[model samples]
Target chain A: MFEAEVLSGGFSNPAQDSARAFRACLDAMARPGRIQQIAGAVPPAPLSPAAGAILLTLADATTPIFIAKSHDTEAVRRWIAFHCSAPVVAASDADFAIGTWDALQPVSQFAIGTAEYPDRSATLIVECEDISAPTATLSGPGIETTQTAYLPNLDAFVANSAQFPLGFDCYFTAGNQLSALPRSTKVEAL
Target chain B: MTDQAYNFAYLDEATKRMIRRALLKGLAIPGYQVPFASREMPMPYGWGTGGVQVTAACLTPEDTLKVIDQGADDTTNAVSIRKFFERTAQVQTSETTAEATVIQTRHRIPEVALTEGQILVYQVPIPEPLRFLEPRESETRRMHALEEYGLMHVKLYEDIARHGAIATSYAYPVKVEGRYVMDPSPIPKFDNPKLGGNAAIQLFGAGREQRIYALPPYTDVVSLDFEDHPFDPSKADHACDLCGSEVSYLDEVITDDKGSRIFVCSDTSYCTTRQDEGHTGRLSPEGEAA
Candidate 1:
């Protein structure tokens, strides 16, 4: 399923690009409410560059991922399966879930994780049409101060954070840009 | 050299840097299992992935490596791990504990006392002692950060209330540096006492769980116990029939169809060394009473 073409002029290996993107993810997640743009592969459509970058970075045979709606295309599935060997699971049982906000179903469908093992909660990568600086207000663990990003919906996220460590961590992916909002972050409604 | 195909120690320099940073934090606060984004190795989980990751981070080309499972260097998993290092890092491997600069183990601590320059790494399936009690990392991290250990004490206290002794015979929980209550892996309780004030640096890695923690030499690690019920590190009453050593942990082995069983030291290397040195028990051909 993987259209294996050795891309020229980029890092010699996909693993190198993966490492770089993964570092961006680590920095983005560790400091909640941060935006980091990553570019490398132009995955087939419905798989945004940002989301594709993330899949390349963190997903492997070790991680289980769930694809919802259009993101569940066979082509995309085959690509991921061939490259990462990451098992696909139901939304309720995934370590990571990918799709647009609607495709993922009710935001509450994913595992929020229990109190003692919040890290068990699934991280969602929501593909968006566009992302810009002039967005909603955000505050959380990674925020040096307060940061804001254009969110699909602010109230749902604010409600999500109220659960405290039990909420799913989210990454908003659009084009080649991505930003993270861990459960520790507190979103404010404008 | 075959090692040129991969980076030093099989892990790239970037991954090593990441693991090294986490190890430093883990060492700064002994016994605290720091959460690290553990990477997928060329090997599978439930094997020696955790120990492999830790060893990958710490190994230098000059270091002599040792790998053991159930305390024997010849065990299949031990041989596999030793071969991994040999292929990836090109480091010298040893079966003797004293000759090793770094030792990775599962389920047994070496009987030979480790010194200051040596490093011990443990393969952990689950690093959280309270994971079965509470299944949320978020809650547990908060619990640790706040120094809340009531749940652990209550669990142990209840165990005593039911059983005449603490029911957990192995993998006993320990409070390190008066802070985090860490799982000491699945070593028999007899080795629990060796966890504290040790001259060698100890590190633990749980791959699937994505956590790494450490114990610096001389760190204070106290086993949990109430004043009324002191911690008991007990082993089987019988000594090894081959080694004649009563001070080591023993694995119960059933030798025949009639259900006759013999107790042998769980630490195979230590037992073999003792037997090689002419130490023998009643069952040995060269035993004093034989």
Candidate 2:
């Protein structure tokens, strides 16, 4: 249902907010392991500001999204429907997915895209309690040298990097803070 | 007059977001072409519609833009693109390479080294380096997935066998971060070395192909070649007649009916900058007068 309260959390100024949010997302992704602050959307419960802003900026009618069970509240659903018009779908079919690292577990379920069209892969928006852990060293494209970040799991990312051009990218969100780990990044324990 | 009907930068917010998302993915997986929903622009496909679309998505009112074709600012295609953005995006335009925050280019990297915080959007006619060697997209995709670049090696080997050297010149192939083999647009092989360890972010867009890819700052971009053969970044071997610069790429110009020729710097800004610094070549206007 497109209730007023649920939609109120959407961007107040869609054009400018989305542009700014997308830039922040671009900056974070361009410089892997670097964290950026994003603001614009005030999503319903369980979604942090970074996650909300990303959803608003990237999701649309054409993009099917998957919301993990922990954050798949009725209000969140309504909010997404009213604001982004994105269809909620299974993880395998989603262009984007959102949830805690544990809730969105078995990352293998999400589409990593085919070799011919790897860009079709899903981008997972992971909610974290804190992103300042400095748990792993990240090295690869976007990183000048090695950079460190608080990733949820290093082994999973190492495996993902092994997949190379066929892995889903991830964005970790903690409140307004955001960071990304593209499949290209090489992850190692700190 | 600019068309006011279109949204800022000529693309709707949703489309820009979609493009931005693809660009990020492209950056993450350096040299891997990420498929995107390419839009129809006012210009033709080969004329840099792809680069134009990418530029439109990345631009803001605060940004200073530059567009070049064959490294010349006055080239017809470059002029048209610069005009399009000036009218539609209402952004400042610059012929000075160093002054631009975002540069959309076709077929050449600037002679002036790009710095941090700048973005280079390349207009690519073909995004796949394997497209020519293996005509089938399906087959090339498999080869890439399997890390089977043997066919490419063979192709280069064949060139070496026939020509006693690698003959392929423009649009030379590069391996990104030692992973995916990428086409660095149609820039001369001379520009290939500049692709690696650059301070600026380089993004490639192929509108007709509907793909986008990127090379982030300081990423490894090795030109594809065998150890025995070795990749050579060769140019015209002539100094620019206008700037007297031997290190820059030179464009050959026919000056007379008798078939006399002169070489000028392909990069106009670089030539002008050198001239401003009192550097003059044999064919310079002042030099000719003297």
Candidate 3:
């Protein structure tokens, strides 16, 4: 059923492309608010290049992915199965989740990890229409002083930052551009 | 084992992804030790297996890899690891501190200032700061959960009361971003100063402990100490006898049976760079006939 979808828009060079994509993701998280360009994967509709690249680079059998309703199309699910083999799990069970800001509502259902193993939390790959301009001031570990970037909702992010070592991280993607806002970053709307 | 049978960088994609995920989490919470499924590598448990695995995951076709063991690139661990990646990943390896995109270190961050985009991966034997004071894993986990670090402070205090100074030198505890008190591997206390506000992204990995922690560039890493007794980054009083370096951390070398000793820069790359620039110390090759 998914033979045709498997052959399209996947990394041409898995070794190099995934490596570069991962580097971009790493850069995005390590230095929050800094926009990094990522490419090398073109999934079915609704999945941007940056999001697809992230899924291809990070998702595997070990990681369970939750596709939100906006990105819950049959083509996207099949592509995820063919490319990464990550189980499509419930929101709470997801190690990673992908969707737009509105589709990923009631974010409390996702795992923020336990006090013991806080790193067990989910990482939401948020697909945005565009990633540019400074909407909020970001300051924390990765940032030297303070940086500003456009996030979907600042209040939600500020609340997430309060969780510290227990909150889920976010990767904001638009087209081939990407940025991240880990829980460690303190977000305040400008 | 056939080299061709191994995947890129020696680790299969799945394992790399697992490690990569752990790494992102580690970076997200600076200095917090994140548990990972540590794999058994071709090498033994103690000799930089964690750092190697981390480096393998972070490495790409475009990266220039560098490996150092106790500040020297020519050591056994460093040479073997560099060779391991060269054969497995076919990436270029360098001895210069500034040249490498990823530097896998077993103690001793390079003396030279690291720039942005460079990643420093440390081989950590013990990733937990409170492991010595409280041996039980469960209790330590509870202490961390409660943000209880009194035991570590008491340990440091006892050392000061006993020796008139913080007796601990290496593997010194540091609080990252005012949160987790982390063990910065076995790097000397003198090197601890470099841990804070450095441009390079610092990553710590312990294969035996199955833990990985990180310090993103410019992260605040405060060495644990009391208010009256501020943390002092101390080194050998003598300068590098070969390179005439005064600021760098020095390794003492016994020259003769008569108790003649000379201090040399622990960082081989830094020392070589200085020496190549015509800097000479008391025991430099052209300075004295030893």
Candidate 4:
């Protein structure tokens, strides 16, 4: 059993909040490395505000989500179940995953989608300590010139970029700040 | 119509979320079409149900929307879509391209350069650039996966072989970010260059085909062309007879029974704006200054 407090604090206005949260997520994803602020949901511990808001906005009954061990608390699970109504599943079978960079290790295990339908790939919501680290150089679509960000690592993302149209996309969140790193982005250590 | 009956924008929240997810994924992978479970809008598929759905998902109460067909806001289809949004979303509508936050377009991009906050949603009949050469979906999927664009190159080469120049004029294919080959809808090749490095976000929806793709703000989009025979974006070398705009795309209109014709700017708003600024052309009223 979980505390009632953990399950109760979802978006006050589901429709409007979700819409606003989604637009924030969309903006961040479209312009990779650009940070955007998002709010609405205050999920349980270990789940950042941005991550929780994203989960509430994007995850639903249809999407199977995988919660990493660091964030796999009863409170987090209860919050997710109550708000998103999404079934928690294994990373391999998940359409979305939530955790920190370390907890989501072996990212290769997640679905990168198939040739016929690359949209089947997984989207990960990674909780980070800071989004403004400014440690890597990013360039590609959405970027007119190279931009910098504080990525968890360079090698893994570069490897992921090499996969091209067949790699999982990622969102990095810290508190209410969010930024995305789509597979299309070219990441290099600064 | 009572607001209680249907959800905002006429789409259920679940459907919007689904489309939103697909849209995010599409933006993540520029120019690559992401398959979506398109819903049955009140309109038919070919008549921009896809663009409608995409617009519905993106619209907020504060957004000012513009709908256009062949770059004209007064066209039948454009009027219909504008009315649909005004009725359902209860949002302000604009005929001027500069004022719109979200512009849903069929066939052509607006002549005015888009700024940072605007979003362009395209109504696409066919989203696959390789559909003509290879009919099989499975084969085309593999081709996209393997980056096998030999067929497209050969087709362009054959066009040059047949006609001294590349013959494709509309629905010109572009490679986005040097990865996926994307179909920039049926916009004339003249607009293909506009697809790249634009400040506004570009979204493409193909309802009948159940596909959605995107080009994020400032994305790199290069038209497919050979080195020697570079892609040439050429339009009829004629200025609008009414607006006198030389750079805008012109539509040929028959003026008389004796085969007399005049060219007018396809972008009605751009033409009207120019005219309001006191610009007159050969076809303007006799009293107006040239």
Candidate 2 Cα outliers beyond 4 Å, as residue runs: B288-290
Q: Can you write out model 1's per-residue Cα lDDT over A100-127, one digit (the tens) per residue?
A: 9888878888887664444456779999
The local distance difference test score of each candidate is: 0.76, 0.88, 0.91, 0.90
Shift of residue B118 alpha carbon in model 3, Å: 0.1
By lDDT, the better pick of 3 and 4 is 3
- By summed lDDT, the worst window of 10 consecutive residues in model 3 chain A runs over A1-10
Clashing pairs in 2: none
> What TM-score do all the candidates reach, one by one?
0.61, 0.94, 0.97, 0.96
Q: Model 4, range B1-290, lDDT digits (tens) per residue?
A: 43657777889989999999999999988888888999999988799999999999998878899999998999889999998888888889999999999999998999999998899999999999999999999899889988899999999999999998999999989999888898999999999999999989999999999999999999988999989999888877888888788899989899899999999999999999999998887789955444
Query: Which prediction has the highest DockQ against the true structure?
Result: 3
lDDT over C-alpha atoms for residue A48 of model 4? 91
Model 2 earns a TM-score of 0.94
Instruction: Compose the digit string of candidate 2's lDDT tens values, residues B131-167.
Output: 9888898888788777788888888999999999999
For candidate 4, write residues A105-164 as lDDT tens digits: 999989998866778899999999999879999998888789898799889899988987
Candidate 4 residue A176 Cα shift, in angstroms, is 1.6
Could you say which candidate leads in TM-score? 3
Candidate 2, A17: how far from true, in Å?
Answer: 3.1
Candidate 3 per-residue lDDT over residues B5-36, each given as its tens digit:
87889998888988999999999989889889
Query: Candidate 2 lDDT, tens digit per residue, A1-190?
Result: 3476685888887766776787678778878878898998888777787898999988899899999998999988888888889999999999999999999999999999887677778999999999987999998887788999989988899999998878999999999999998898999999
Q: Which 10 successive residues of model 3 chain B have the least lDDT summed?
A: B281-290
